[model samples]
Target chain A: MIKFSDKQLAIPKLMRPVYLVTAGQSKFDRAFPDKRTEELCIDALTQAAEMINVTPAELKSYIHTCYYGHFADHFGDQLLGEAVIHDRLGLDPLGNCGVKTGGATGGTTLWEGVKAVASGYSNCVLSMGWERMDEVPTDEGNFLISCAADKDWESPLGHIYTGYYAVMAQKYWKVFGKEEDSFRRTLAEIAVKHHGYARMNPYAQSPMKITIEDVLNSPVVAYPLRALDCCLMSVGAACAIICDEATAIKLTKNSPHKPLRIWVTAGSHTLRPADRRDMAIPLLPNETADQYKDLGKKFPGGERYPGFTGFLAARMAAYYAYNQVGIKDPTADLDVIELHDAFTISDVQTYEDIGIRPYGYGRDYVESGDCYHMNPKTGKPGKLPSNLSGGLIGCMHSVGATGIMQVFEIACHIWNRWAEIHGDDKLWKKFDRKKPADWTDLQVKGAKRALAISHAGVGSHVTATILMDPDKLIKKDA
Target chain B: MSMFGQVHVKNGQYKIKGDFHELTPNMPIRNSDDGWKLMGVTNPRDMTYIHSYGGESIFFESLSKGKLMATRCDNKKCESKGSIYQPFRIFCPDCLSKMTVIDMTDIAKKTAKIHTFMVCERSGAFNILKRPIKFINIEFDGVCTILMSYLAVGEPEIGMRVVPIFQKLDPTYTILDMAWVPEKTKSNHLPKGFSF
Candidate 1:
């Protein structure tokens, strides 16, 4: 009989025993006129390789397989994959395929990387998501997103993507008796915070500073959804490398000057078909609860859940991640969180859904400065600092690449390299740093554990990933 | 078993004796453009021109003394705004909007100021080869939008006000007959009784 220790059970090694050896990304923006999809992938891959002191050819030797996530305008599947392998990299991968799960593509891709290493099929794998949505005309681009929904019922009525979310916002208002300004104010705070953080990130798109007033007055894409409330459309690529423990240690020794080492603790996915599910009731509530229970069971006694959710699907995923990671008190245990803010309202609602704040108290979390940078005790600057990388709001949404971009920013924060270039501007004044000290110290101490959540609305696909510092692993590899 | 072939020539031409062949004459077939008529598609009905001795005017005096009109320009470039005839409206084909309109009598009498003018070298069904087609951008008195008309005359230039002349088609009606001429031309002036 096998007896599982709490520590050993908490962070399950990938069946293949994978480690995030290196991660890299290209700039996120509404469009990239000079760079194509393949170019962006190559640029990110090259940077990731260099960060770990390896060349593309060198990294290819360890890659047993590669999975890509791309959502281009047209003929993207056939052309983008081949273009990356043959034209850009000049090497044919042993195995290469693609996945599309709407906005959750990024999180799903990371989960795939985790699964690949854990399952032992490959000691090393490369996962990437890239999109170039801005190249197409706006009307035609919108048509592509509409294709993801139930065409028979939704498309015929001229139902726009924003309108779908607007209906949900309206329903939430009626059910919770929440004021419209409450949701709007929460969204504005989120956008302002993320935009503030985005000013620090070089790769973020639309890093301009925005205020709640700006969010309120912006043009309305849908009722109660001003322009600022909606995410921007952008072009970008994010990549991560997952390898086994032995390989990770070997690589680290080979290049001792590498960044932080984070491991995937838990991951869960839930698919809710729009036609079969109840739209009014929050989707995947049961599945999300189960995920949290499972994570808790894995990590017996933690202070908080350390879980966060940005969308309905993200809520379900966060449940599982929190369960596996054993987060007892999320507000105190978790160091940093990155969530999908496809719209402003999502941020407020996600706070409750992710179990971060109680159902009605999400607003208090925002106003109190507990989630953002203005916490008196933390003495940091910015809003919740949740979607600090401008999130999908300031960065805009590139369906396939949006989710992964959130993960990449979170990973950067955990790795502690996020603030290296973030302190040079007037934006840092928000931090109220009269005397400049190392920014990393301001990060939640003992914040070796972090959570990333992503989801898709059309089909309700949710994915969550928990990353932890490898030093905390209970059982050392023999 | 094997097969053998032999070649022979008769009357300075090679002929096959084993198998005889006959020649047939080819006939020429005529093709017509009648089946190619444009249909199911929208075209500029207000842009088609009517040629007459009245110097290429777009309107005519009806038997009832009211003005009748049609489009006059056949140029592909001018199709975007359709030819300005009676209703004298400036239409943009791209945006499909009426940019401006003016009275037909004012155009015929050359009471319009030339905003711009262009001389063309190409001629087809749309132009008379012997006579240069001078396209003028003319703005009538009291009208905001300008009209493009053909100038019959002395080298077309900006600021040139040309009047239109009409030829009587019957006792009570007239047809558009001829190009815009200098305002000073006696035949180009509007009749005393004409109101618009």
Candidate 2:
């Protein structure tokens, strides 16, 4: 409803064009047993700053703001890290702080950084996120999230997080009249695919390859959600740099290699859980059909298309970005996608919600191999990938840091710098021509147009960002 | 048949005992204006009575079946002759005015909505066993005020509805019990022709 531009038919001036330029992350795993949150954050910040060819002193003057994302108690602010970064680097910016909003914290911070550069507030801004969850006992960590539930009603009645989600899952089954195995298989297939992709990501927390059989055999935690269907809590940090076109060109000109320019199209945050009118309905209804019909109009084609479902919030956010940036067909328009996969079930759901498949046909989309890592559906073999950096399932989830990592991965892939680091065993090799069955061609013929979606569960907050190739924008000249 | 006894002992001697005392009929104790008064007694004529005590008590008077009765007062501020209670009072507690009694048995078994509830995980003197208890506040239908009770359900949602059930313990005493279940049709055993 809030249109940023009308005449230009592109991103509004309020939401300026900014490029990712540089993205760096520390190794993601449970291997860092003794490492504190501050240590992990500084390591990640140092890596990202070094890649941009900017000294700490130079970064301080240009960075208008900094946001740190972490859910762990003391680590949420990373007080010690903030002090060390400022003192050691001798760079004190105007603003620097951290925030938390559960698992969506990472993506939220990245969006904030994007807003900063787009709004002309700062030429260069840094957003960093890290979590040291493995340091604490599992019971204590579980208690932190559980404490958020309504104490008087739900909590006292023996309802925990698993039970809460299980009840919703049960309601879904009851209403749809679907078998439990059907839902279980959907989660298993997604987990297996992400696990397979993790083999190509060096920073994945659990990089070992897995099969559908393995996923099906995994221990069930909450009925349909098996052990493999869920994500692991590991320790790591991801950071990104956002700057205007002039600053981006200047920074890349001085660099040793070409930089990745991420042109953000649209971004927004939507309603919380308590405000929702209907709880039983999917988070985002089929936008192309339901939402467009309500507006009394249709797209260029007369067909009433299905919208994304699984990662409802993220998928909706992505749709807004695509619409704002003049992208009508995602399958034919975008080259790659990096979405939050909090659970394997969410990944399959996202495929459906994002219009990658027809309604109730997400499973077929995965089985058909068109959306596979190296598929030629978009005409480029092994180019149009989803969650190429292993996503949240493969990477460590420091709640707020996961979303920023999605943007960072897309930036690295577009810059062609990602494959150079494939030498590291920590990085997984996703595209293997020898095993053609394991790889699918996306068929993307031109440069890449990337999309990212972020979601916050407690309040049901969702945000989406779209990045198009700078060359395309240059050609359009609008 | 009647039985009575009396004990006797010498006043100043510890070693010697006296003969048995005579057992006589003692007069009932009474309160006198000029002498010592007994524990619980009131004068009939001189007592300042708040109201006339004649015919039958209001509670007993109403149990005769079809009679709709209430206490009456002459106060000018009496609104609707003061609100009526089940036993029916003649005067209002605020205005002290007489009120007309109206039959409310037709609507007595209706439902109420729960306002709030608290779950008690621990009960005094009980340990090693966790018995969940809920304390709820409910607003009855057509009643402006709310009542508090121990909710029978283990967990109470905010807007659950409940029905009141009444049982007569004796000719002089009656008990009221309320229970909440998922909404359903009233049982056939309920009084016929009364809408809930």
Best by DockQ: 2
Instruction: Compute the lDDT of residue B67 as modeled in candidate 2.
Output: 30
Off by over 4 Å in 1: A1-13, A72-87, A254-312, A376-384, A421-446, A473-478, B1-196
Per-model C-alpha lDDT, please? Answer: 0.54, 0.51
Please provide, for model 1 over B1-196, each residue's C-alpha lDDT reduced to its tens digit, 9 standing for 90 to 100: 3223334567966544332332344333223345544322211111212223232233333312443233333345543333443323234423445434333553445456654444533222222223334444455543323443455556665566676533343322321232456677654343333322
Error of 1 at B38 (Å): 37
Q: Give the distance in Å from residue B142's predicted Cα in candidate 1 to where it truly belongs.
A: 69
Worst 10 residues of 2 chain B by lDDT: B41-50
Off by over 4 Å in 2: A1-15, A52-61, A72-90, A148-162, A171-177, A180-183, A254-257, A261-275, A278-312, A375-384, A425-447, A474-478, B1-196
| Native contacts, share recovered per candidate | 0.00, 0.00
TM-score of 2: 0.61
- Top-scoring candidate (lDDT): 1
lDDT of 2 by residue, A280-308 (tens): 22222233334334211222211111111
